[model samples]
Target: MVKCNTMPEVRSEIDRIDRELVRLLAERQTYIEQAGAIKGERSAVRDEARIEDVVAKVLAEAERAGLSPAIAEPLWRLLIEKSIEHEFTVFDEKKKKIASA
Candidate 1:
């Protein structure tokens, strides 16, 4: 835990954490890409069962981390939605390549 005595320090630490969060999101995206590769259709990109499972896990983790589920749920929902969009793009591009080949 970092203790900050000034606004500049607090802002700087927040910025640093934001950067780390983005990096982790990027890392998670690699697995999402892998999922796209393994899936047979764009429709598979949005798995309601998986979404519920993920949200459950995220909610649990947020509770453990002392974060509000109110915040985590919506944020994770948006992330999942954007990820599905990315997976659809990846799926379509792969389909195009296969068709071309």
Candidate 2:
């Protein structure tokens, strides 16, 4: 048998924070969907400046939180690339509809 140290008092707060994190992620997805709408009017270009700005913000926040900026930068880059792909998909679908009409 293994004995584990546990703090029952703060566990509820941690659980609440986790739920909030999930909620924020869902909200973020909605914004990504809107990003697709925005892309429809813009050029089909992978804006490196946008990506750099996102990376800088993520790294800065991670550093402020006493976390590893190195890991945060790469992780954020991955997320930004995925978001761009999502926006492109939206733009492509909208374009098709416009062409077919």
Model 1 scores what on Cα lDDT?
A: 0.93
lDDT of each: 0.93, 0.76
Residue by residue across 1-101, what tens digits does model 1's lDDT show? 69999999999999999999999999999998888888997777888999999999999999999999999999999999999998888888889999999
Q: Which stretches of candidate 1 lie above 4 Å from their native place? A: none
Residue pairs with colliding backbones in model 1 are none
lDDT of 1 at 39: 99
Residue pair clashes in candidate 2: none
TM-score of 2: 0.71
Off by over 4 Å in 2: 1-19, 41-45
| Candidate 1 lDDT score at position 74 | 100
Residue 52 displacement in candidate 2 (angstroms):
0.3
lDDT of 1 at 80: 96
